[model samples]
Target chain A: MERLSPRIRPVWLTAAIVQAAVSGGLLVGGAVGLTRATDLADAVGLAESTVVQGAIALAVVLAVVRLALAWLRYSVWRFELREDALYIERGVLTRVKTVVPFVRVQHVDSQRGPVERAVGLATVVVYTAGSRSADVAIPGLRPDRAEDLREELRRLAIESEGEDAV
Target chain B: MSRLHPVTALTKTLGYAVQWASVPFFLVSILSGAFDVVRIDWVFSLAPVGFLLGAAYGLVEYYRFEYELSEDTFDLASGVFSRRDREIPFRRVQNVDVSRGIVQRLLGLAVVSIETAGGGDTEATLRYVGEGEANWLQREIRRLTAENDEIEADEQEGLEPDPTERPEPATAGTSGDRRPTHLFELDQVELGLLSLTTAKLSASMVVAVVTAFGGDAALGLVLSLARPFGGPAQLAGASPLEYAALALSSALYGAVATYLVGVVYTFVGYYGFRIGEAGDDLVYERGLLQRYSGSIPTEKIQTLSIVENPLQRAIGYAGLRIETAGYGPDGGGNQSAIPLAKRSRVERFVARATGIESGDFDRPPTVARRRYLVRYSVIAAAIVAAAGAAGIVWGLPYWYASALAVLGAPVGAHLRWTNLGYDLREDHLLVREGFWRRRTHVVPYYRLQTVSTRRSVFQRRLGLASLVIDTASSRTFVRGTPTIHDLSLSTARSIHADCRERLEDARRTRAREERALSVAFT
Candidate 1:
């Protein structure tokens, strides 16, 4: 199994940080809203400042945990180009190992989302004929590399001469 | 081009009248405000006009509907104001089903629906066609599909899985050698047996139907009628043994009701279930009030599923379902090819249909057995905890009784592990699983769409993974995707590679075979 490009680490970290920040921001806003709009803290016999402090503390803890797990997730993520199929092993808690044979691949595409674009990374997606687990994606690759991978898989899929028909 | 049967005018008119008149009638009543504040009794007159319009629409549809059988395509033109025309190539036609309800049957008419490769909806439907025409259309389409294969084989190469060329199916029909070889016919005894073993969940639908027809008052009346028998249980001096006996007898009564309901359901659904082989096609005709005659090319069958419930398994009888890419009437791609058959006969049928050999399954590793034991034990413990929690909350006694389930966890786990096994053969992949209704999915390598493996956190620690094999069939009646619950990571990878190679090899061989057939055809 090959790990994703080392460059993907920063991009994943950025995404995880942004996600955590947004969630933390929402928590802060909710805490402020509750303190201002209702006497929930007073009714619960707790000070408003304590609620805000708790939100900030919980936010920091969650962010730290999320960023730490993100590092682990990056470490665990892997993709292997087998002779006849593309194998991907991912997920942190629940490990998923998927093998999409070249013959079953209907189409392939290389996409660069905002986060990926920010870090000069691209993702190559393989759409298979199967309904479930239809889209297989290889994330955190250079644009040129993603394009090359897509072309190679497409060529292999074409060469396999799958029925494409039932 | 030919118009729809004249009977459609009458049939569609009746159908539309009911459908259309109800809307205006509903609006008029709603606008009338329970006939209190608003006196719009004159608005009721609009129902007749709507009915007339609907009748006219139906008649126009019948007259305007025109279909033509060309050399390669089936053309259809219909619709009122917006003219819609569809041209379906014979090659794309997956299934041709002829079905009829009471009205159509009485009128000697059938609704012929055409199914294609994409989506769940029926591609084209002829409202009411002559029974003879429906049959002819089915036969003609099959012939054209075969002819198309011969012509397109050279250009398209091995892109299509040609169902017709395999058995030289259509030439026999063209030569007028139309003798159909009978495969399986459901008998009275077999139907009864099938009904008896049916899931009680469906039998509860009998109560819903009864409620729909007779209302809640009737149900209350029934309960009241049975109150005398139930009253004995509530009697102040009732013995514990009497109460236990009453509960047992009531359970028996419920079981009997389920059997009776199942009898009616299966009997109606599969009354004259007769499947015969006409060339390479399995032509099935079944039903009591609503009859259906559909043909699924044996070569196009994606998967073969053998379902045997505990009772059926004990009696050595099983149900076989034939799945193709074309969706069936009930949104599934499976047809009950053999609703009830001898287990041995079912095995033979599966072998004949997909070349799936009957052999011993390779059981999962010893860790899988331990995994099941651990899972079941946890579940049992959870139930005991929940029972205790509920007891404390509600002040209920006998909370300890639920703990007894933990003792049976080992037996449950053993049975579950023993039942789960898979056999990867040369041409077919057989996966047998499930304890209650054991389903053995026989998926030919030719139909293998994709294969994937997954493992949860607990499984990863145990070095175990699950394999999921998919086919082109979309209906997730647990149809094409047969999954093996537990296998070593290395074994899973090997199996995945093996499956991928086998699928490619099978397709290559099948393509070569088709090329050879095309050469012979020309």
Candidate 2:
């Protein structure tokens, strides 16, 4: 279980890159405008070029720091299915735990987007009768693993219902 | 059971023609105004003459409409010069809603709207019938349909019971007597509590006020209070205290007006509120100033819900709304048979009417956690913070505004979310949701016509999906729950599968039991 999955690293890397690009754009725009409006470059006893370079470096460093934090956030997410319920634990610093019983299940749906399909993976969604936010979806499962899990859960849910196993 | 009076169509046609004639009259008025601009004085005189002609045409059309009843079918004929005929089989008629408008009250006529399950635009209507005749027709239709169903059941069993022997009441197990069961009736206290909880009254009052006083006045008054710091000078130099006094007085006046309108509307809408069992059907008759009578077959009612608003919770009152199949103006086109009743009473009623057992669940439905408060507050807080920050940056006083926002937004959100809940029992699924006017719907396992599951990308990441259940009731047609998930995908699939299997099992068991009974009797 401790063995690192190469695919997982790329997923986090891609997300971090996207976040960095957005944050970088905003920070650069703000710093550049501030530099253009103020005479601080001359008053600071530093060349304007040196001040501009410093500002750009500071913004890049900030974006990189934020991206590293996000990478750590996604790494902690984990899910497991037990005999009676499905369990999920996820968080960066504040942990969240969720348990959904088999009997409360209403319907199940499987979905795959371009990214997931490219990775030969699929997501399974579970719905209950009353709770909208309580619904959960599990993604990044290999096709075979997802199908096997679906079958196993279906069996467990039917047995738990104790009436019809259609 | 008796037939409807033949004058229904004529009265209805007269009403329809009068309504249609208004368009042409308005168009002619505009045309006359245009002509007057060019000094055509004679054209203006034609307006009144046109009105008279339109009224005369309506009267002629009214007399031409007529309908007759036969043993298994009802026939209607209408149209002045060109005759249009409609034939409706008794079995196809889903429900009969009899209502009386102001005109009907004056003329001593009742209007009957006949609905059917088949997907067709044609609906049979009988206008200008005596109230007594309308009631008789309703009973006749119900009796005929019930008799047909019993015969069909007997045929399926290959044995027919004697017609002389009375069939057992549907609620025989719960209620001792065979007399039609009255499920629940709202007393004065229950009615008052219901009025306090629901905004139906206040919403209607707002509509009435806006219509009476132009929208501009309403908007101006609202804007003045919302941005009070804009100063008295902004409101034409009125002193702060004077403006405050005016606002307070106006609010007091509005509140009084709202209360009166609410009481009157409630009295009319739910007057003589009654829910009773008649054969294999449930009947609802209400309205004070105008009467509305409708009936739903037990088999056709797809879902039943008992809902409680905050006010109702304090007073122990809950509203029961039924969802049925077929297309009506409202969703699922199921009518509210008993709009308001005590929660305890509604629970007892559901247990008695349907064979399913009823009790409080070990856990409230998960949707209660997703209540309106949590969802709305999250959005409201973000929006308000952003707005407050922008306002402060723009040199506006933000403290007072932010304080007011903080006080109201979260409370409103929580109230909305707290009222939402859903429970999936062994035999039925119940959904309770509403912010101001709460409603709960109970849907039986067998009556579910379709089940669907959906998921968005974010939901997929969280391992969540939404499930929708559709029934035949028109009332629940628009009120179907969009997102109900507390289970995993496989679990949901199994639940759907189980429900379908159980439904089949019940059908087979009933058939086998009927067969065994018939064989033994023979």
Candidate 3:
């Protein structure tokens, strides 16, 4: 099995931070809106300090948990290229092992998101001729490595053209 | 080059008129204050005109419809106003199915549905053609495909360094007079048994009758019958014994009626079921009123499914169904390759269909995976206990139902535990599963598109794994993915690896054949 780029940890951390920020903002914004619209603090018979402190503590704990899970997920994500197939093994709670045969692969491509671009990492996607769950993505690769993997897979797929993929 | 049978226009016209009648119904409902606040009566008069227009359109569409069969391609041109033409090469044609509805049967015509390797519904349907013509077309197409393969082989030999040597043993040894081989057929007694064992006899009808008149209508019926002499007051004063007797009789009546209806339906559907092999095509002819005949090239078969219900299993009988690429799209198309046969006969059919001998798949499956069975039964028992406790608390008689669960759990577990098995032969993998309706799927290694292993949260705890194998055929998805569940992790891993290796080998051989052909052509 091959491990992805080490830079992926920070990229995952950035994504987790963004997710935590958005969720925290939504929670606080919702509380503030309720208070303004209906005097929620007074109606609930609670002091403003109590409500604000509870929200802050909740957000902080959630953000910490999210960051930890992101790191764990980054560690578990791995992929390998075999002689006749490509295998991707990932997941934190429920592990998933996917294998796509070279003959069954329809195409391969590399994509980079904004954060991935900043972190100088790329993801390679393999589309297969399966009836369901037809595509698998192997993320957290250097752009050059991702490109090379894609090209190699494309050549293998072309060489196995007359094989019955179905 | 020719049109459909003259009777086709009548059937198509009726179909179109019925489809378009909805428009008139919508207009009438809206304008007559049936659905909204309006009161225009003139639109009611337009209903007749709408029907007439629909019929006219159907006639025009029928007139424009045309099909032409050339040497290597079948072309169809249809549509009333916006014409569309479709041409399918003989190589692309997968299977040809002939079905007849009541009207078509009455007119001595059949609907010929042409399927292709491209999935979805049949590529084209030549509706209401003479039955003989439909059979001829199917046979002609099969012959053409065979000839096409022969031409490719001959060209390859011409280009070979030594023309005398034939490399393919399978094709070389069997180039004799192509004759139809009678495989199996259902006799009167076997057909009766099969119809009796078929699961879910008119389930929809049972549901409909129960929902329609089960409660109030049943009570009213009892009361009305009782009121013939003394009216409602006397019936209200009836003894408890009388009510119990009435309920018992009604239940008996319902069950008997349901059984009779189911038997009649099964008989009609599979009256004269027969299956045979003609050259390279497997043919099926069956049905009582609306007889159907269909043929599928053996090369197009994706998987072989041997199905049996509990009753059939008890009597040592099974049904055979084969899945091709374009069959069973959106729950339509003929999927029945054989209606019913003895277990040994069905096994023979599987051998013929897969080219794997019966002895190869005779190895008993691993039985140590019964831990999954115990786990499932334990969960079921827990549910039963919980529900029974809740029912007791709520003052309901739950023991009657819980008794069923208690009896069912062990029986189900025993059946599944014993039946579930997987055997890997030289060229194919057979996975047998199901408790009441046992089905064994015979999938060729070359037909496998994907093979995966899944470990659920519970399976992980038990250190067990499941193998899910998928092919291109759609019927596999309908019956649930062909899976061999509950094996040790190491064993599952080894099996997965073995399948992958075999798949690679199959692909290499196919590629080599294609390369040889390409070199010959160039």
Candidate 4:
């Protein structure tokens, strides 16, 4: 069993906050604009200021909930590198556990997105011959660790090539 | 190094130029303020010049593309601006097909499509090869794939090649003595039945044609014609008698048109359809206009499917499909081994071809039925309520009549639940599902790529989960994955574990079989 780098928390939180903030800004702007352009505040029996403030509150609540979910998601995510296969346990609402055999590995790649690069973290993706679960990605690893994992999986896959997993 | 038939360059260049003609049109439109500043006639004239430039680019592309067959790999290198090289191992090759269209026939050329494992579609298309050369290449590729396996086996056993025993490629005798052990060709009666039944599909095509040309106005006319039987004739105040006559005439016309379309499509597709077994491979050839012939190696098969629609089921007829890891030339990952045949015969054929028993399936627990009932009933209720609301809003008469459909919800749920079953036999796993069009899938244990159990929030509340069985076949992703739904959580977990363990055993069995076969060949 393995855990992701602890530094991924900040990246996840930042992404969640940015996503929520943009939608919140749009909502607040739309609410304020609607009050000035139409009679929405009057129809809802609320003052213009109250409507705008309500929108702000809703946006803040949504952001907080999203942050909580992200934390929970991080806690639940884990992977295991077995002798013959790789197993992953993930998801919060609709839980999913996947098993990818070593011999099925078609290729492997290690990537560093802008956010991950800033945090000195990387992600490794393992591709398989299967159609649906074709690509499996493990994020939030130190760059050196991600490379090691990629090399190890590649070697293991080559060694087990005689098994004809495809 | 090998060069393709010289005419291939011409055909490819022409196709490339014609396809690229659109780019200049868009560019001109954008530059000329959407053709306002530029004269329409002038723009039209400029298209020819675009074609000329595109032809030049096409020539470069044709010259750049190159392919060669090596001892163990098929190498391809193609690019105009940058170099891209790929080497596909022979053992990974799944299917090799040769096809020809009218234009290719006129040119005395054919296309060779080679598909490999994990290759999305036709991995390589050697377009416009001489007809005789295409056939030779097809047979040669198969020989190389077989030889690759033997070489690997020998290498593992540390055996040196005996030059005296192994024949030279140039002198290898090509004979036609390898005839099919079992063969099936669609008869006239079966073809007629297939055409008539499949016209139901083309009925949708008739509707689409009506929609494309007639649009909403024609639909309204049809609706008015249909109104006498559907409800009161209020939309069109014409006399009921005249409307009923028009409705009958249009209905007859629709049926005839649908039947004609269906017959043409079916006949054209399945004309001279023949499937035969030549050694360990299933060879198929079909089509009236554009001919297609391919071979599917038995061991490369991922699963076998037996499909029966309502009409076919009533007549004891079924269709058989073989799924593989990669797509064929036409991008149909699943090959229709038999479009229509007797159910019993198809079953026997599949069993013989795949060498696996189609065992009886075990039904899910009764509680799963309750869950399906609840889920389907809820969906039916939602649809009814929405229709009722829409009816009232649109001032439709008898708004409450939609409620009648909700009562039939239990029937739908029962059919769905009854059809859902799975069997984990000794050698293979069987999953039978689908109510409208029943499909029974026989997946050998070795082809079970991954086994997973998923639980949604709703499933958790109902103490149920779904077990998904994945293969390397591409159809598993596009269509519904072969999932056994509404199993009790415990049952799902146990089945998942059992399936994984069986998969391990199957792998060992596969290795042993390959070893034995190699030894026998040696």
Candidate 5:
């Protein structure tokens, strides 16, 4: 099992920031209108003050929870290549284990977005047709490692197919 | 290339204007009617005015639309008041379907649909064109495409043929150098037989009629029928004799109606079904009133499936479908190349065409951890009992509902779990599914686009993972459940890794072989 390093937690932090910004903006705007309807000295029961404080608190809590979950996810997620198949294990509370055989592999694709590029990481999306939902995206891979893994997987797929053909 | 007639814009705009204007007219009518509570005469005047306006708008748009054509493209520039233009490339075209409505036929015009590989959203259509020009365009597109394919194939073979390899001796009589690439064509008898087995005549007719009537009329009819037959009241009380008589009469009526509808459906859907090989491509032409012709290059095919319904199984018939990269023009993701076929003949035809041996794949395994029928039966029984209970609560005859539910349990269960099987072998993966129409998809390892394994929380508890194999064709999805051989996570990971390695090796080998051949030839 190979786990993603804790340093990758920045991606989750970025997501949290975006979420908070949007939610916080809406909450603050609503609160501002409520405060305007009441005098600040007697604003204890003002809708604006309550709404703005509640929203900011919720955002902060969400960001904290997100950061904790990201840590757990990174620590739990592991992928290992065995002699004949590829195995992936992940999840915090509910464990998921998937094993894909080499012979069954059709193709492999690698993608990188700005966020991933900034962190010098890439994602690999493996697709299968057997199930309605067969695409699995493995993120947080170093580009060189991703390329190497891709080549290795391709080789295995062809070899297994050849063996089966015989 | 031809340009659209300038009048086309006028007609299109007129049509839109009519559509928009109807809203205001209807609103005014409703408002006037509301005011009629005070003065009824105003309502009468407004209704006629609205009606007249709508009719006038429709008439104006009807005669204004037109289009233009060129050697490599077609332009549809139509609008009245506000203009719009659309350009379609001939090369991007996948199918040219010509349809003649009664009105179009009377006017000596045909509607041409130009379909492309892009999903259904971007297709271009010509609402009305001269019948002669429509026919000419269809033929021209087909001819150009065929020529392009031939040239491509020749380039592929000529560029790489090894010197050590002996050139195939040119056949005598018909252009020795040019092999008559057309390999097979279905005559009327074959086409007729094929249609007999796979054609859902009634379903086709329903679809055609619904399309003809448009969406609203179709929805209205469905709602009318479903209102009475659907829901708990359907299973309610009756004496045995009365129930039997009702069933008998309904069955008799249904049989007669179905047969008549089937005839119309078959006639309309598959009026002139034809399958032939043109160069290296398989060309399929079908339709009753609207003739559609499409061609698929052999190389584009990812998988071939042979499906057999219980009725077809008894008659030794099958349906042949080819899975390709793009969505099919006729709505279905998988194209029915030979909609209905003789099982034996279709197998032989595929083998000859692809140079793949017949009977190379294994039948899906029948044995499983448990009999699927038991699970199906249990679920069916539960559903029936629940329905019967619901009926009883609704003040229906409990005994009658109970009897019907009990009788339906086995049948329901059997249908649910029927024909679920998967088999993995060397070279290919085979999956057979579907209760009524048993379909066996044979996917070659080479054509696979992706391989994946998934496990739900429940599956993980059972120590099972589902394997999925995908191809370029959107239709084919093969999944093996319960983790074949109870493969462990590490084993599965390694398997995927190995598969990826093997694919690369094969590609390298193929590339090396082609290089060697090229060098040898030079």
Candidate 6:
């Protein structure tokens, strides 16, 4: 299988970092509010350092885990286009392998989140018929490659449309 | 094509009255506490007036409902204030089911439910038609579908009917010349056997139903009733042998009671169960008090599953099930093809359903795969061992539980490894697996939407792979996707390649057929 583009590393890392920042920021903010408001702290029966240290530890753990996951995801994300189907493999802990046949493809679209756009990457989403978990997304492709893949899939799908009703 | 039976008005009114009955109980409960509600019965009596109003409304609604059949479509128009009209084409209809409940039976009426291609519950349900009228309507729809096919075929051959040539109405005389062949039917003995073997987890259901009807006090009553007979050891210092015999007899009594209950249930639900094939459709009829009849077209069937539970296998019998599009939990359709029959009978049924020669599925799984299963079981045993050790250290003496894992792991691994099997025919694929409920899924290549060989980190190290074959019918719980797991990498690869080629061939032939039909029509 062909590996996804190397630039995907940075795109994934940016997403993970943003996600960690939001959650970590919430915990730290809550801890700081508890520490500064002594009356509230006294009512809850907690000291300032305990809350502050726990929040810091949680933030550090989240940062470390998210960064490691991003790298692992980038390494594992791969896809290949066969004659009649597309194969995809991704996930760090629970690896998921998905296959989408051209005959069953209903539609395809290229999506770009703000972070992906900033990193000059796009994700192509393939919607299939008759399955709840059949949608396959190929992320971290350059815009041109994504467009090319989408058009090729569309053509293959049209060619096979007469055979399968869905 | 007309309005439903006249008694339908009464049934609809009764349904509405049931909903309104709760109001009186709620009002009485609320007012009995603070106010002297017992002194003023009229305050609690208003709910009857609500029922009367609902009954009057139902009469008007029943008067507004109407339906008619055109040459090519079934038209239903119903509503009291806002008129709604629906026209379903004959070509789009998939299966037609006729059902009757106790109330409908008393009124000599039935409910006809029509399901179409898309999974939208029921495309249309014509409620409470005369029993004879419901059967007539079902046959009429099937005849129309057949004629529509013939007309399309003729049109494709450049023999399009002139504008002056009006389509002929399907009458009793001109539907089909094909006679229906009697396929299978369950006798009293077979029905009893089926019931005895059926898995019933209905003890909880029995408890719940009794509680619902009798309130919380009934639970304690039931427990007290059973207490004397349930515990043989507690019955005054008896001999060990006597205690064991009592326990065995009680268990036997419970089993017999449960079996008798199941027999009654099956006898009522599956009375006169019969399957007959006419032309390209299979018709099934069953049930006693509430009868049901359904017709499924042969082409709509996606897969044929032959299943055998441990008991059924021991008795040399199996169950046959067929999956059609939109026929499952979401579709509100029944999928029972055959409840249970001898193995030979099942093979014949399979041959007839698929139009293929009788095939065998006796392939054994590989030894290497068994090793992997044993290794996985060992890891689980290790975890249990660690937990048991920890329990022992904590002074709970729970390490004895570890013996269960030590013994059960090997048996489970062996059953799983031995049960796995797959057979790839030229035009079809058969996958048989499961230890408790052995199932063989026969899928034609044309039905397959995707076939992928997957390998995980563990499989990679072992040089093993698994094949997943998916079809559109995966939307249903009864028709699951067939997966052939734990094969050598080379074998999996070859199977994948073979499946791909067969799928391509099926698609090409399908395209050619469509092209030929289109050309003939033009």
> For this target, which candidate reaches the highest lDDT against the unseen true structure?
1
Candidate 5 per-residue lDDT, tens place, A1-166, comes to 7765455678766876777677766766666665676564143434555666876787677766766666677777788877866777776545555556566565677888998889888877665433322445677888888888888888887776432111
lDDT of 6 by residue, A1-166 (tens): 8787889998778878999999899989888886896665554456777778889899989888999999899888889888878888876754556666688776789999887888898999887544433347898899999999999988988876533343
Q: After superposition, how far is residue A103 of candidate 2 from its true place, in Å?
A: 25
Summing lDDT over every window of 10 consecutive residues in candidate 1 chain A, give the lowest-scoring window: A127-136
Could you estimate the TM-score for every candidate? 0.78, 0.61, 0.74, 0.82, 0.59, 0.73
lDDT of 2 at B378: 69
TM-score of candidate 6 versus the correct structure, residues matched by position: 0.73
Q: Give the lDDT of residue A144 in candidate 5.
A: 88
Minimal lDDT window, size 10, model 2 chain B: B169-178
> For residues B406-445, what per-residue lDDT tens digits would candidate 2 score against the true structure?
5666677565545545566755666555666566666665
Residue B118 deviation, candidate 4, in Å?
Answer: 1.7
DockQ of candidate 6, scored on C-alphas against the true complex (2 decimals)? 0.20
Considering only chain B, report the TM-score of model 1.
0.85
lDDT of 3 at B451: 76
Per-residue lDDT tens digits for candidate 3, residues A70-147, read 999878888888887888777665566777788887678899999899989998988654444343788899999999
Expressed as tens digits, the lDDT of each residue in B1-522 for candidate 4 is 566788867866787677667666777777787546765455587777777777887788778788888988988888788888888887888888888877787888888888887655678888768999888777777777767765664564444245433322321112212564447888888887787777555466766687569967976666665655553344467554545455565676577777787788788778888887655456788888888888776667788888877788889998888888878753456888888999888888766644554557788888878877888889888988876765655444555777877887899889888888888777677888987878888877778777767788778888888887888877744344578887888888888878777877766556454333222211
> Which candidate leads the pack in TM-score?
4
Candidate 1 chain B lDDT trough over 10 residues, lowest sum: B513-522
Off by over 4 Å in 1: A1-83, A107-127, A133-155, A162-164, B13-21, B24-65, B78-85, B154-177, B212-214, B225-259, B354-357, B478-480, B511-522
Candidate 3 lDDT by residue in tens digits, B1-522: 879998878867877776677687777677677655554665566666777888888888889999988877889999988899988877666778788878777667888888875445678898878977887777787777656655654565565556345544334213212555566677898889977876554555774576467787766765555443333433466654455445455555556667766777778878888877666566777889877777776666777788888888788888887776665422433367667888888777566545555633332234433564576678778878776654554343434466556566666666676777788986788888887777888877777776777776667777777777867665535455588777788888998899988876765454343333222211
Candidate with maximal DockQ: 4
Model 2 global lDDT (CA atoms, 0 to 1): 0.58
Error of 3 at B501 (Å): 1.3
Query: How many clashes in each candidate?
Result: 0, 43, 0, 0, 63, 4
Against the true two-chain complex, what DockQ does each candidate achieve?
Answer: 0.36, 0.03, 0.21, 0.47, 0.11, 0.20
Judged by whole-model lDDT over C-alpha atoms, candidate 6 comes out at 0.71
Q: Which 10 residues in a row give candidate 6 chain B its minimum summed lDDT?
A: B513-522
